[model samples]
Target: MNASAPQQSNSTPLCYSINSPPFTYNHPIASAYYSSIFTLLGLPSNLIAFIVLIKSFKEARSRSRSFFLIFLGGLVVTDFMGLLVTGCITVSFHITHFNWRNLDPHCHFCNFMGMSMVFYGLCPLMLGAAMAVERFTGINCPFTRTSSQTKGRPISMVLLVWFTAGCVALLPLMGVGGYHIQKPGSWCFFLISYKGNDQIFSLIFSVVGLTSIAVSFLLNTVSVVTLIRVCCGQDRTQRRRDHEVEMMVQLILIMVIASICWCPLLIFIAQTVLSEADLQVRYLLLWLRFATWNQILDPWVYILFRRSVLRRISPRSDWSRSSIMTLYPTLRETIRRLTSSSLELGEMDEMGKSNVTAPPTLKP
Candidate 1:
C-alpha cells in the first residue's frame, strides 16, 4: 500500500516550461481545425479584393482617389502575405510538433517568426491610420494639401510603413526586446513575464498599435461627419458629392472591425506588462484568436461596402452618396431629401410656366 503512491504528481507544471504539452501545439485535430478556418476565411477574400482593386484603380478619376486606391492595394497585399506566411509556419509547427530548442538551437527561427508576427500585426493597423489621414486630407484639407499626395507618395508611404514595422520587429534581435515561443508553442511573440527588455518591447508594441487605432478613429469620424454634411446640406449648390464617399465607407468599416478585434489584445499586452500579474493563458489565447479575426474580415470591408453593393440592396438610389448606409442611418434621410428635391424641382418649373404675365403688359 505504501509503495502504491506514484512518484510523479498529477498536477502539471506551468505553461512556460519548454516542450510542455500545455505550452506546445500537441493537439493534432485542433490544429487541423484552426488551419482550415484560417485558410477558408482569409485566402479568398484577399484574392477577390486584389482583383477588385485593380479594376477600381483603372477607373479612379481624381489624383487623390488614385492614390487612395494604391493604398488599398498595399493593404490587400499585406493581408494576403500575412495570411500566407504565418499560416504556413503555424500549420507546419502544429503538424510536426517540432522541438523549438532542438529545431532552432540558434533561436533564428524563433526570432524570425516573432518578428513576422509583429510586422504583420502592426502593418494593418498602421495602414488603416494612414488611409484615414489620406481621406481626411482629401475631404477637409484638399486646398491646403502639400506635395504629399503626389503619385509616388502613397506607394512611398506604404514602403515606409513596412520598413518601420520591420525595424520594430527586429528590435528583439537587437537586444531592445526578445520573443519567446508563446502558448501551444507553434507561434512566437512577446511574453509579458520577462522583466527588463521584454517588458519594454511589450509596451512599445501596445503603444504603437493603440496609437494607430486612436488616430484612425479620430480622423475617420471627422471625415465621415464632413461627408454626411455635404450629402445632407440644404444648399442646392452642394449637389455634387465627393466620389470618395464610398471609399470612406470602406475605411470606416475597416477601422471599426479592426478596433473590435484588436483592442482586447493590445489592452491585454499593456495590462500584463504594467501589473506583472500571473499570466492568464486562456485570456491570452482568447485575445489572440480575436486578433486573427481582423485579417479574415478586413478584405470584405472593401468587397462588400461598395456603391454597387449598396445599389443592389436598396429600393432605389438616384444619388451615388446614398451608398454610405453601412456606417450611419442618417444617410437614409439624406436619400429621402434628395429624392424629394427632384420632385420639388419639377413642381417649381410648372409653377413658373403657369405664372406667365404676357396679358397684363398688353392691357396696360
Candidate 2:
C-alpha cells in the first residue's frame, strides 16, 4: 500500500495537470461587437482628422504657423496609423475568436500586435508631453521664441518620437521586455509573466509612460486655467490672446479625453507590477477595450471641440492665406496683429476691408 500510495500521488498530479482546464475569461462576443464598432466609427473620424491636419499643414506654408499645429498633425497621423494596424488586427482576431498561439505557440502574431500597439500608444503620450511643454514655454517666454516653429523642427521632433518608440518596441524581440498573448487570446502586450530584467523593463516603461501622460495632463490643466483667466479679462485689445485661448481649450479637451481612456489601465498595470499579482483576463480586457476606445474617440474629440485656431482653414481648392483673410475675421485680426501690434483700430478696419497680405503672424 505504501509503494502504491507514492505511485497514486504522482499520477494524481499528472492527471490534474493534464486535465485541468486553463483559466480563460474570453468574452468573444463582446470583443467582436466592440471591434466592429471601433472600425465603423473610428475610420471615418480619423479620415476627417487626417484631411483637416493636411489642410493645416498646407496653411503653414503661407501663415506664421505655431508648433501646436505641427504637433497636432503628427498626433493625428500617429493615431490614424494606430487605428489602422491595431484596430484591424484586433477586429480580425475577435471576430474569428481563434487563439493563434494554439497553432503557433511562439505567438508571432501577438508579438507583431504588441510591437505596433506599444509604438503607436506611446507615441501619443510622448507627443502630448512635448506639445504641453512647448505651449507652456510659449506662454511664459514668448520673447524667447526662435525659428523652432518651422517645419524642420516639427519634422525632427516627429522623427525622434518614431525612433524612440521603435526602439522600445524592438526590446521585446531582443529579450529585455517581451510580448505574450493575453487571455481571450485575441490580444497581446508586454508580458507581465517575465521576471528579472524583463519585468523591471516593463515596470520602468509603465512608470515613465504614465508619468509623462500625467504630467502633460496636469500642465495642460494649468494652462487652461491661466488662459481662462486671460480670456475673462476686460481688455478687448487681446484678441490674439482670445485666439490662443481657443486653441488651448481644444488641446486641453484632447488631453482630458486621452487621460480618461488611458489612466485607469496604466494605473492597473502599475499596481499589478508592484503587487506581483496574477493578471486577470477580464480586467485586462476591460482596460484594453477602454484604451482602444481612445482610437475611436481621438479624432472625434478634435472635431467636437474645433474652433478658431483649430478650425479647418478652408474647403476651397484655391485656398490661400489672403483668401482665408477675406473669409475669416479672426485671420485678418491675427495677420494685422502680427504685422503691427500698435496698429490703430482704424488701421485694422482698413486692413480688414482691403486685400492686405497676411503678415507672417499666421500662428497656426
Candidate 3:
C-alpha cells in the first residue's frame, strides 16, 4: 500500500512519493463527465427529499411520525453532504490532477478525504439499520416504542450513529487503522490488508457494514410481513391504514437499495482481508461505484413515493376500498405473500394515526 511501491493493478497513481513532475488529468473528459453526472443526479434528488421531509415534519400530527421523520431527514442530510463533499473533491482531482504529495504534504488533506469517504459511506447504512429498529419496535410494541415518546430520543439516535461512524473513520488517526492513497490517486480509502492494525480495521469495517445491512434486512422483513398480515388478514384493523405506511414503504426501499449497493464492497473487504489475496484495486473501485448508486437511488424513494406523488402516479390507487392497492398490485401481493407468510407473526410500527384512509373496518 506504500506509494513508492509498484501497485499490482492497472491503476495509475496521480503522483509518486519520489520526485516527479506535477500531475495532470489522466482521463480528463471521462472523469469530469462521469463525476458531473453523479453530482447532478445526486444533488437534486437529495434536495427534493430534504424539501419533502421538511414539509412532512411540519405537518406530522403525531410524535411518532415526527420521530421517524427525523431519521429520514438524517439520511437525506448524510447523503446530500456525502455527494457534495466527495463529488467536489473527486471532480477537482479529475480536472486538475493535483499532485497528492505536493498538495497534501503532511497527508492531512488525504486523511481528511479518507475520513470523509468512510464517514459518509457508513453513515447511511447505520442510519438505515437504526430506522429499521425504530420501525420494528413501533409496530411490535407500539406502547413501549419510547423512541417517539420524547422528541430528544430520535434526534439522539441520529447523533449517536453519526458519532459512531465518525469515530470509526478517525481510527486511522488513532493508529488502529490506516488510510492510503488508492487506485487512480483521485480518492483515498482504507486499503484491504492483512497487516496488524489494518487487518483489524478492515475486519471491523466489514463486520459493521455487513451487520448493519443484515439487521436492516431482517427487521424490515419482519415489520413488513407483520403489517401485511394485520392489514390483509381476516382481522384487518386501523394499523393497516395508519400513516406509518408511508414510512414503511420508504424504509423497505431504503433497505433494498442499501443491501444491493453495499453488500459487494463489504463482502469483498472481508473476503480479501481474510484470504490474504492480493488486493484488486479494480474490483474495489467497481464495488465503490456500486455503493455510490445508493446516494442517487435513496432520495428518489422520498421524492417519488410521496402520497401526493403516488396519487398522481396512479390516481386509481386506494387503501380502504382495496387491500393496500398500489399501481403494481400484483407485485405488492407477491411480496406480501413472500414476506407475510414466510415470517412468523410480528407487529407494525404505530408511528402515527391514519393518513391514508378514512377508516378501515376494525375488529371489536
Candidate 4:
C-alpha cells in the first residue's frame, strides 16, 4: 500500500473511536431569531432618522441645529451599517445550523462585515463626545462673549471622529486583535480566539472600547449636570430663559437616552473579552446585539419624531440685518451715514428735503 493509505487507516481508527462534542443548534437558532427581530426594528428606524436629518439640515441655521444634524447623520449611517452586516450573519447562522466549516464565503464576508460594523459603530459614540464638548463650551462661553467662532469647528470635529474610528477598526485586519472567523460555523467576535494567545488580543480590545466609552460617558454626564445647574438657577422672570431651559432639558434627555442604550453593550463587550469561561457568553452576546439595535432606534424615536425641537429659522429665507436696512426706506436713511454705500448717501440727501425725514444726527 502507499504511505498515505497506512496513515489514513491509523487516523480513521482513532477518529472513529473518539467521541466528538454534541452539536447544539440552540445558540444559533436563538441568535438568528433575535437578530431578525433586531433587523426589522433597525431598518425602519434608521430610514426615519435619515429623513429627519435631511429635513433638519435643510432648515438649520443656528449652531445647535447644525450640531444636532451632524450627530444624527453619523448615528443613522452607523446604525444602518450594523443592521445590514449583523442581520445577514444572524440569518446565515440559522440556515446553516452554525456550521462554520462549510462556509468559506461567509467567513470572508463576516471578517469584512465585522470590520465595517466596528468602525461605523464607533461613530455615534465619538459624535456624542463631540456634542457634549460643544454644549459645554457653548454654555460656559456664550458666542456673544467668545470672539472665537465655531462656524467650521463642528464639521472638523465630525471628520476627525470618523477618521479615528476607522483607524481603530482597521487594527484587526492588521493582526492587532479584532473579530475572526470561528470554527464549526459562523464568525466569532472578541479580541482573542479561545485556541491561542487570545487573551492578549482581548485585553487590547477591552481597553480601547472601554476607554472610548468612559470618555463619552464622562463628557455627557458633565454636560447634562452643568446644563441643569445653569437652567435651574437662571431667573424665571425672563420668558426667554424659561424657553432656553426647556430646550436644554430636551437636549439632555436625548443625550441620556443615547448613553443608556450604548453603555450596556460596551460593558458586555468588555466582559466577554475579559472572561475566560463560556459562562453566559451566548446570552451576553445576544443581549449586546439587542442593545446595539438601540443605536438605530434612538435617533428615530428621540430625534426624528421630535422634529419640532429644531429651531424654526431658515438660513436662506431669513433676511439679514443688512437686508432689513435695504427693504425699508425710513430705516435706510437713518443708518445711511453708518454704511459705506454711496447710493444710500445720495438717497439720504434727497430724502432730507422730502416729507419722509431722517432722524437728527447725534454726536459720536
Candidate 5:
C-alpha cells in the first residue's frame, strides 16, 4: 500500500464523526424542563382520554360512536408512548450521567423506545385518516350501509390504521431505515445525520409524512363539503341536521389539527434534506420538537370539546337522580307505586279477558 493512503483513510473516518459540541448548559436545562412539562401534560390528558373512551365503549354500539372511541383510544396510547420514550431520553441527558459505550442495555432500550415512539406517534394520524374516510362513505353512500350496517366499516378502518402503523415502524428494524443512537449518548432519534443512509431515510420519512397530510386534507375537505350540501336546502328535521353537522364539524376539526401539528415536522425534514446550512437545520429541528408536542395536545382537544364523549360520561338519569332525591325523600317510593299501579292495571285486564272466555268453567 502507498504510504499516503492510510492517512487519507483515517481522515475520511474523521469527517464522518459528529463533532457538534453539546448543546449549551442553559439550552439543555431548558429542554429538560420543557420535556418534564410535556410529560406532565401528556400523562393526565391521556388518562382522561382513556377513561372517556372506555366509558363510551360501554354505552353505545353505533358506528360513529365506536370509531370515535377507537380514535381516542389510539390517541391516548400514542401520547403515553411518546411521553415514556421522550421523557426517558430527556432525563438521561439532563443529569449528564449516561455512558452509551459502556451500557449496552440502555443503548438497546433507547433504540426500542425511539422506534416505538415514532410508530405510535404515526398510528393515531393514520387512524384519524381512516375515520374521515369512513364518515364520508357513510354519509355519501346510503346503499353501502344497507349492504352491511353492523359497524363493520369503522372496525375495519381501525384495524387498517393499526396495521399500517406497525408496518411503517417496522421499516427501521427491517433495515430499510434505522434509527441512530446520538454520539456520546444513549439518546436515539430519527433526526438527520451523516451516518448510515440518513439521506434516504429522511427522504422516505418526509414523503410518507407529507402524503398522509395531503390525504387528511383531502378527506376532511370532502367531508365538510358533503355535510354542507346535505344540511342546506333540506327538508329534514332541524335538530337531526344540526347533530349531523356538529359531528362532521368535529371530525373536520380533528383532521385539521393533526395536519397542522404534523405538517411542520414534515416540511422541516424535507428542508433539512435539501439544505446544507447548519444554522437553518438547527432552527428547523427546534421547531420540529415543538410540533411533536402536538401529539400531547390532540387528545386533550377531544376530551374538552367532543359532546358525544362528554354525554357518554354524564347520562340524563345521573343529572336528574341526585336533585330529585334531594327535593323529595320519597321519590323512590313514588316511582315504585307508579310501577306497581301500571302492573296491576295490566293484570286486571288479563283476568277480565280470561273470565269472558271461561263459559264452561263457571260451573266449577
Candidate 6:
C-alpha cells in the first residue's frame, strides 16, 4: 500500500522512520468542498421536508397516506442525523487537518464514529426496504383486512428497524467484527483490511443492503405492471388510473436513484474484502462521497413528488403553466389528475356497486 520508497539513507533524521509513508490528504480538497456544500444544502431542506411530513401525517385521511408519511418522516430524520454526525466530523477533520487514525488508541471518538457510521448508514437503507415491503404486500397483494393493519404498525416497524440497525452497529464493539479508521482518517467503518468476522459482517451488510434495493426495484416493477393491467383490462371503461401510476412511477424512480448512489460503494467494499486488493485511498473516498449523496438527494425526491407542495408552488399564470406543460408534461398531467374530483366519484361508484351486488333479505 506504500507508494513511497521503503529504503532511505542513514543520514535521514533520527525522529523520522524510514519505513513511514508520506502523509497525504484523502482527496482533501474535493471532500471538504463537496461535504461542506452538501451539508449546507441538505440540512435546511431535510428539516423543512420533515416539518412538511409531520403536517402531512396530521392531515392524513387514508391508510396509504399514513404509511408513506411515517416512512418518509423516518427517512428524513435519518438523513438529518447522518449529515449532523458524519458531515460535521468530516468537514471538521478536513478543515483542521486532524488525522483520526493518529489519535490515541483508547479515544472514544473512534468508537463514536464507527457506531454512528453503521447505525445512520444502515438506518435509511433498511427503512426504505421496509417501506417497499409494506407497499408491496399491503397494496399489491390480495388479502382481507386484518388486525395487523392498526395505526401502531408504523411505529412498531420504525422501532424494529432501529433496533436491528443498533444491533449491527454494536457488533464491532462486541468483538464479533472490527471497526477501523478508513481512508483519509476522518471516518471509521467496518474494517475492510481483514478477514474474519469483520469481513463476514461487511459482506452481510453489502448483500443485505443491495438485495433490499434490488427487491424494491423488482416489487415496484411488478406493482406498476399490475396497475397497468387493471387499467387496461377490467377497469378499461373507468377513468384513467394516472394518479396511481404516477405515484408508483415516482416510487420506482426514488428507489433507482438510491440504488445508484449507494450500490457502487457497497460493491467496492465487498470486492475489497474478497480480493484483498490495495486500492488508492482517494478512489475509495470518492466513492464514499457518492454514497453520501443519497442523504442529500432523498428529501428533494419527496418534495418534488409531493402533490400538495407542488400545488402551492406552481404558478397560475398562463405562461408558467404552458412552460410547465412543455417541460414536464407528465408532471403537469399528474397534478391535474391529482386535483380532479372524478377519481373520488369513481371510488364511490365502485363501493356502491359492491353493496348492490350483495344478497338481500337473508332469513335468520
- How many residue pairs collide in each prediction? 0, 2, 3, 3, 0, 0
TM-score between model 5 and native: 0.70
Give candidate 3 misplaced runs (Cα > 4 Å): 1-30, 146-148, 236-240, 319-364
Per-model lDDT: 0.78, 0.66, 0.80, 0.56, 0.60, 0.69
RMSD to native for every prediction?
A: 9.0, 12.5, 11.0, 13.6, 13.3, 9.8
Q: Residue-wise lDDT of candidate 1 within 44-89, one digit each (tens)?
A: 9899999998998898877877888889899999988888887888
Best by lDDT: 3
Which sections of candidate 5 miss by over 4 Å?
1-30, 147-153, 183-186, 191-196, 237-239, 276-281, 308-364
Off by over 4 Å in 6: 1-22, 26-30, 98-105, 236-247, 309-364
What lDDT tens digits, residue by residue, belong to model 5 across residues 223-252? 777766554422333323433454566666
Which residue segments of model 4 deviate by more than 4 Å? 1-23, 28-31, 92-107, 143-152, 182-188, 191-197, 233-251, 269-280, 304-364
Give the clashing pairs for model 4.
Answer: 99-185, 100-184, 100-185
What is the alpha-carbon RMSD of candidate 2 to the true structure? 12.5
What lDDT score goes with residue 226 in model 5?
A: 70
Clashing pairs in 2: 64-362, 66-364
Question: What's the lDDT for candidate 3?
Answer: 0.80
TM-score head-to-head 2 vs 3, winner: 3
Name the lDDT value of residue 64 in candidate 1.
Answer: 76
- In candidate 2, where is summed lDDT lowest over 10 consecutive residues? 12-21
Tens-digit per-residue lDDT, 128-172, candidate 3: 999999999888777786543687888999999999999999887
What is the lDDT, from 0 to 100, of the residue 144 in candidate 5? 69
Candidate 2 per-residue lDDT, tens place, 28-126, comes to 644567777877888788889878767766765422244667777788888888888877877887666554635444346666788897898888878
Residue 306's lDDT within candidate 5 is 58
Residue 39 CA displacement from its true place in model 1, Å:
2.6
Off by over 4 Å in 1: 1-31, 145-149, 315-364
